[model samples]
Structure formats: structure tokens, C-alpha cells
Target: MTETLDPEDAKIITLARSVRARNGSTEGAAVRDETGRTYAASGVDLPSLQLTAVQVAVAMAVTSGAKALEATALVTEADGPAEQDLSVMEDLHNGTLLLAGPDGSLKGRHV
Candidate 1:
């Protein structure tokens, strides 16, 4: 269920929503690195490439030298974060994962 998000968590959620709207994508995600940096991305689907929004955000964090995540926010119409999305995030570190509706309302949270 929805919890009161601290400013940091709210920031990522906002970023995720902005990306989803701007990209016209079904899913958009943002993650905060342990270093306080944030990365945002939308789902990618091409003939030769496919990645969930969370995956792309995680990749961006890693590519930027993020060793662990502080938190993650995903905004979409889906029921919840996908299984693969959970796996990839756990691979880095155990952090809060927030799932929000397209309207920016929190649907669920996993820790």
C-alpha cells in the first residue's frame, strides 16, 4: 500500500512519471544510487532489443559506477514491477521498490 514518501523517493517517482509521459511508454522507472545520484528510463522495445524500464535504469546506474541502489520508483499501468525487474534490482542491493499507478498514486512497495 502507499506510504508517505520522503522527498528523495518522491523525486524519483516524479522523474519516472515525466519519462513515461514524455516517451509515450507503458513503463517508466527511476532509481537512486547509494551515492545520491538518480537515473531514469523508459521501457525499450525494438526489433533487436527489449528491456524493462527498471532494467534500463539499473543499467544506467551501473554504467555510471553505482554499486548499490538506495531506492527505486516505477510508474506504470502494470499490476506491479515485473519479476526480472525485481531480480536485477536485488542483484545490486536490497532497497525499497515502489510501484505507482500511471496517475502517480502508489500501488505497492517491496523491500
Candidate 2:
């Protein structure tokens, strides 16, 4: 079974091991560790805006997971700088894997 990390614990993990994107599949795959971040882009050819929307939507889906349905997921990547979709569906599908430190320093880049 895949060991899914707790939303908070995922933040503590250091770096990304690898990522695999599936063509035409809603679920993408990613693994992280102390090495570095890795990602596999999605197959859906979506525009930057649409891709952003999908990423936001997928993050919402991940955070909701079978518990809270009405609450919105943390859209940190979108909250900062320019919101370019950038084939981030896989990352969002993986959910929030890292967080900002106590002083607001980002521990890891989401995508």
C-alpha cells in the first residue's frame, strides 16, 4: 500500500524523489525525500489558466479526500507570484507536501 503522509507531516519531509504523470488519468504520482523534488507533467493539454484551475481543483480534491467537502484546500502556489498553471496537476493531486517555516520561509517549492 502506498504510504500517504499526513498533511502536516508531508510538510516536514525534505525533498522530492520522483513524479509520474499519467495520460488521461485524474490521479498522478509523486514521491519525495531528502534528495530533490521531481515531477511528471500531465497529459491533458490545458491552457495556463485552465491548468491553474485544474490544479486548484485537484488540490481541493486532495484536501477534501473523504472528510471535509466544503473547505477549500491550501493554494499556496497560487497565492504567490504569477499563477502559471505549469503542468502542476500531478503536484496538486499529491496534495500539500511542504510548508513554510515558522518565520514564513518556504521549506520547499510545491511544483
Candidate 3:
């Protein structure tokens, strides 16, 4: 059965795509940071999100970083993102965003 993507999952993909563009790694490694700084040149955000995803997948599968890239690629291709699959993606996206922030973490509640 074809599973419909959850709104949240769709949101994650959208966010990821935006992040990819901001990083400049979507095409060939022109990735940038939130401040528009090129990460490839600075090495602060080494290993693009694509690379990080791979690393996480590998680490989760084998609990090792050796095949992180391979594992992440496999998982991404096979699963993609859907409602049922959104939880993990949300966590991943949120984590990246939080870390990317100026404070490297979310601020206190506004309320």
C-alpha cells in the first residue's frame, strides 16, 4: 500500500531542502551556513546533512561510524519520508536546526 506522507514529514522535507540550499551542498558542495558563510571553506559544518544522515543511519544500524555514509544513503533512498516515518525525521531536523542556531540551542519560551 502506498503510504501518504504526514504534514509534519512533508514539512521536514521542505525544511531539509531549504537547509540544503542554504548550505549549498544540494548540487555540488556550495553549502553555506545560517549566516551565509560557506561551510566547505570553513569546515565548521563539515559533512553535509546528506553526509550526516548517512552517518546517523550507519551508526544506528551497526552502531559504528565506519559505514555511516553508506548506511544513511541506503536508508534515505529506501524510506524517504512519510507520516509513519516522520518522527525520526522531525528529531533529526530539529536537532540540526537547534545546533545551527546562534546559541547552538533553542531559547527560553517566549510566553
Candidate 4:
């Protein structure tokens, strides 16, 4: 992980962690739109429908009419984001992806 993190990115990390804790989910993600609005979500794991936190966050942005994203943060136990999650970010915008551990410590990053 980078030694220094942008303040906005840090906020997303915190937001993602909060979502994870509140929902008691395995993962959580937060995304910032071009306009600076942020969205946070925990993984959706219903029997009939399943989606990663990043996927849900991206969908929320799109449904809210956000044309592009500025950055994304994911709090997960896994080492990094899944390929499908990264693809969703790529589809909307080429932005930084921050990965954080359950304790909310930065673990890695992809730009």
C-alpha cells in the first residue's frame, strides 16, 4: 500500500469499513463519482442474487446518473479486488482502487 493516501480516498476506506461492520457482510466498498458524491455498499449475497460490494456501489452510481467515477475503496479480507470488480471500475472510469484489510489498514492499491 502507498505510504500516503489522499484524504478523499481515506474517507472512502472508512466509509467502506463502516458499511461492512454495519451490514455484517464479508466485504464493503465505496466509490466516488466525478462530481465528488460518494456511495457505499456491502456485498449482496441473497440466495437468488449475489453481487460484490464494488459491483453494488458501481450500480448505485450508474443508477444515480453518475457518468464517471473518480476513485474506489474496498474493505475486504481478500488480498485484492476480484477481476469482475476491477472490470466494473474500468468500465466507468480509470481510477485508483484501494484495498484495505478488516482493520481498515491499507493493504494494497491498483491505479
- Specify the highest-TM-score model's number: 1
How many clashing residue pairs, candidate 2?
Answer: 3
Best candidate (score: lDDT): 1
**TM-scores for candidates 1 onward, in order:** 0.96, 0.23, 0.27, 0.95
lDDT of 3 at 25: 41
Candidate 1 lDDT tens digits, 34-89:
99999999999999999999999999999999999989999999898899999998
How much does each candidate deviate from the true structure in C-alpha RMSD? 0.9, 11.8, 14.4, 1.0
Clashing pairs in 2: 15-33, 16-36, 17-32
* Structure candidate 4, residue pairs in collision: none
Q: Write the per-residue lDDT of candidate 4 for residues 6-92, one digit (tens) a residue.
A: 899999999999999999999999999999999999988889999999999999999999998899999999988999999999999
User: Each candidate: what lDDT?
Assistant: 0.94, 0.31, 0.26, 0.93
Per-residue alpha-carbon lDDT of candidate 3 for residues 1-111, written as tens digits (9 for 90 to 100): 233534433333344344444555421111222222221111124465333432333224333222211001111222122232234334333222111212112221110
Q: Give a tens-digit lDDT track for model 2, residues 1-111.
A: 134545534432221111111243332222222222332222234565334323444343444442212111122222331233333433433333332322223434443
